[model samples]
Target chain A: MLRSLLEFSGINPLRLRMSWVSASEGKKFADVITEITKELQEIGPQQSYIREAV
Target chain B: MNVQKLKEEAARALGRKDVKYLIGYKKGSYGFRVSPAFIEPKEDIDQLIMSPLCNMSLVKYVMMEETLPGLTEQALKPSKIAIVARGCDSRAINLLIEEKGVPRDRLYIIGVSCQGVIDQRKIEARFPQVTEPAEVTEENGNYIITVQGQSHTVPKEELLAELCTVCRYPTPLIYDKLIGDKLAARPFHYDEIAAFEALPLEERLAYWQQQFSKCVRCYACRNVCPRWYSTICSLDSLSPQWLRRSADTSENFMFQIIRTFHLAGRCIGCGECERVCPMNLPLMKLNRKLEKDAKELFNYESGKDPKAKSLLTTFHTEDPQGFIL
Candidate 1:
């Protein structure tokens, strides 16, 4: 719902991602983080939505 | 449509031992203004009034009522309060109960089926400053606006509020006592939002950036919302300062986004936030977009059932997770 709302507000919905992993699934969590990093790099720097150019 | 029934109901509610006061509309001192009347025991119900000019939602004032800690409905000094409710206002009460902001038994809802309301701004713009009290009556899709010795007829469609045009619920869903006929709900669509969505993302961003830049950060939108019942808002909190006091485009964007997200499934479309905003920001468009999304994605319509599970907190086993990384 938040994702959709952000998208509607003209913010890229891809910037917000939700992932669920069990306590023991450390590898799965790391992989998810790596995947998000690659996606974020492709999406470029968010300008209008964020506070500063991080 | 019966003013007498509304007065009788208000008098009855005020006569109750537990009810502190009945909040109804009364004639304003000047033109096109309708004030929220708080009727007490000694006060006559003749002061109570209702019209298409009564555009402000009394639900926000109800939520603003003092609710001290450990003050249960049964134990409080003013155990119950009554208010004149329209279709949207009734939904606001339901949303409050669903979030535990207020108890059900503590409110006496006198329901009135609304045939939409005239936007105060629209009327003001059309008939600028007449200083004197103006009378408006609805008849045959026309508003007979009487100012001074002159009378002018205006089409209701031109003066009707934007939120009212798409209102599905014309009758109160829950009411302790009803005062008018129950009207059937209207089917609504998001033609404007759909058209906006069809535009390129860059144009959409530019549109919003311009709107956000105009915001003065007055917090009128936050203060007027029926669902913004937080005692200490995150914007004011030091621990996790959501947005700065600055009124720049970025900060305004943050403030609005946070607020919009907070009201995801709870906003009942009273459109009070947009109504009260001094900047004339298109806040309802943002709100309605979320409403449309919530309906399409979760198959949820808020304020329909107070006892139903919340949309954001509850997850179905078969819930769609296409966005999960």
Candidate 2:
């Protein structure tokens, strides 16, 4: 719900990312891109739904 | 039955040369309030009492002992502080141990089998302007309260704290001495959070906005959190401040998220944050939501074991990559 809100307000959900950065894993990036893409899809077409919502 | 035996056991523990003190509860000056008592002598054991009013989580003071500033030279070592801990308080101890915040040997915990504590707010609401000291005892199905020389039989539902509704662990997981009969653990339920989430997105945002606006940036929630005792909190880090000092909607939102995220896998569901919040924000809604997510996604529960690592800190090779890629 919150991601959609930000995305609807023209803020890129992809930009406002939350990642679990491990202190031990300094440079592990095997799944960073995939995670970003997945989050983007979840933030789907919020402009229409959010407008109706607001 | 168990209360007296518990006192005898504590007195025995205190008699030992190595034992420093026994922490217990005593009657407070006001209605439905209990204060922590540090008993070093056998006579002081009589002053301790446990009732529905003894809702305080004494695990916080385990790390609260006064320590000297910055000098590597030690004048004295840490004392073994024995405390009366309930289920939730025991979890705090476990969390501290998990984070290496406190050594296990240094703590002598007298664990109590908790029967859900009363919500002081609820009781106060039902009996406002109470001047005299009062008592709340659990009976067959109701709480018998004696306030101002009048006895009132209140329904359990009216005085029970919301966290008690879904508590799955009523008895302490770890203890050196035990108190009270072990009650059966209840099941976890997120009915309140689910109901809140059922609201429309706009309404949900509005509800949160109203709640967040009332926040005075007192940091009471942060101060009371057992998991948030970093010498330098991330919120105060100037190198790259994640949250701005300004108390605007954006900043408040960021602060809340940051606080919740920090406790993603570390929150023990003690409800201390909600209890200490002066604004009375439904902060637990956010926390329980994250807790529910962490449970579903990782199959993990925080503070279950001291040796267990935090979810964020520990990752698996077969970690779900579907979310990112």
Candidate 3:
């Protein structure tokens, strides 16, 4: 719902990501962060939702 | 519809020696307002009235009394509280009981079969200048609103609340003495949600940003929520403030997200949060989105079955895990 709300407000929801990272899964955690970074890069900056007046 | 019978039931409940008081609706001081009335004595039952305008959830008051400070178990004798419950209010009561927020034994529920409630905002907008108290009665799908000794009849659809229009449960799911005949449950409809879901991500984000930007963060939505029974809300923690006092869009978004997430499987869809909202934010859309997703993803509906545990609390191996990755 939050993601949808953000998306509705014209923000790039891909900028936010959630993943299950276990204590011992160091490699998996690194892979998740790398994937999210790539995704955010592709989405570019969040605009429109953030008003200029504010 | 039968005011006499309703008053009679309230009188009987209030007459009970063990009943602390009866919480119901009464005529407001001014036009079209239905205030929650606390009936302690049998004589006070006469003041109780049930109408299309009695849309306020009484379950919040029950939760309030349960958490009231200085009311230790030994301080006051344990007594049952008789409450006039509509469909949503009963569900809230059941949810509270299931969550162990309130004891089931401490309530005497008098259920009223609702035919949808009128939106006060809509009514006030229609009749903007009525300062004196007005009486509105429903008849043959029309609201006969009398203001200043002049009667004007309006179609029910013109004033019916959006939530009520799509309400599935019109009769109380749990009640000791049901007053009116049970109403047939409406079929589920998610057209609004589907339309929103079909929108492109950017547009969706833009729409919510605009709505959320106007939020004043009054916390009325949290305060009116029957399930928000916690003594200290997570949003109000001083050690780590989840939400800042600044009413900026980003912080407001965070506040809304946190609040809605807390009610993921617990919101009863009473629409009180949206009704109490001063800014008239479409809070129900966010809540109903969760409701829709919870139903589709987990095959769960909150406050429907009293026997079932909350969705987040209980888990099965076969539960949908598509989002886990």
Candidate 4:
């Protein structure tokens, strides 16, 4: 279902990844998001669900 | 209708060499109340009876009973206890076995083809002061109740439990001995959930928020729910703290959300949580809505198959995903 959601958003499959987060792992979640954001930027702005700033 | 046949089957099961005590319903201390009966001997099976008043789901005993006191190491093997299960109770039993909470070999079920049980609240509202034990017998579409030597006949619809009124399965799904034939299936509908869905999002959120704000962190809902029985309740863990100890609104909302989501595709719509609620919150509404959504979106019904994986645990590649946003 998560993959389906990502696919529907027109996100590139190779750039996105999944990670598990425990309640005590705030830093881990933050770090994963940071890495994912950088990777997304490296992949450049592809035409996707988000058209503009909300 | 076949009360005697049920008792006989229970007796036969109890008399089996490998069988332990059979669990059924007995009279409660007050009116319209039923208590769990643990029948051991064949003679004791005579106490086993089924009626509209016998609404307590016997499936809970599968997971609720404490291990026998000071048993020898050899005696620690799982006991094969028999259960007399109604439609909803049978589903719960199957859920327990599916989740591996109870071993399949440890259960012997005498499935009763239920004609729907009565709601104690409705009965009490109609016939109060049944201080002594009462009898509920079915006769020609009506339940005849006798208390303190006075008899009253009420139409079944008037006292039918809220869950039973909307029940789809009147027959037990699994059993060792079938006591009676199945009833005609009712038209399955989720009108209550539809009504709730028709509400505006703000109103719906507000409605739940208001109800959840009243929660006292009593844990009665979790304690009474057959599915919520894990070695440790998710709410109790300190590392994650899914729910905080304080009874404030923010924590209460989180608690209710997590609890309800955990039961998303698993609740049998037993109405136990609603009945056990001291504050009379409509907990079943939230549960029934989830049950409805599961049916509509995933075409999934919990406890129908012992081998089937849970809805949330196994996701389909083509599952509806656009609604998540």
User: Per-residue lDDT of B23-58 in model 4, one digit per residue for the tens?
Assistant: 888878777788888877555666667888887776
Most accurate candidate by TM-score = 1
Interface RMSD of each: 1.7, 8.1, 3.4, 11.9
- Cα distance off (Å), candidate 2, residue B136: 1.3
How would you order the candidates by TM-score, starting with the best? 1, 3, 2, 4
Identify the leading candidate in terms of DockQ: 1
Off by over 4 Å in 4: A1-54, B66-73, B76-78, B323-325
Per lDDT, what order, best first? 1, 3, 4, 2
- Candidate 3 residue-wise lDDT, B1-325, digit = tens: 7789988888888777878888999989988888999878745567888889887999999888878788877654547999999998888988898899888889999999999999999999999978888888899999999999999999999999999988989999999889889888788777898888788875677777788889999899999999898887778887787667788888788888888888888998999999999999999888888888788878888888778898889889998665555
DockQ of candidate model 2: 0.09
The docking quality of candidate 4, as DockQ, is 0.05
- Share of true Cα-Cα contacts across chains kept by each model: 0.71, 0.00, 0.40, 0.00
* Chain B TM-score, candidates in order: 0.96, 0.92, 0.98, 0.93
Which candidate tops lDDT?
1
Q: What digit string (tens of lDDT, one per residue) describes model 2 on residues B46-137?
A: 88888888877787766766233563425224357778888988888898888888888878888888888998788889999987889888
Total clashing residue pairs per candidate?
0, 4, 13, 0
Q: Which stretches of candidate 2 lie over 4 Å from their true place?
A: A1-54, B66-78, B238-242
lDDT tens readout by residue for model 1, B154-197: 99999999899999898999899987898998886889988888
Give TM-scores of chain A for all candidates. 0.84, 0.42, 0.73, 0.57
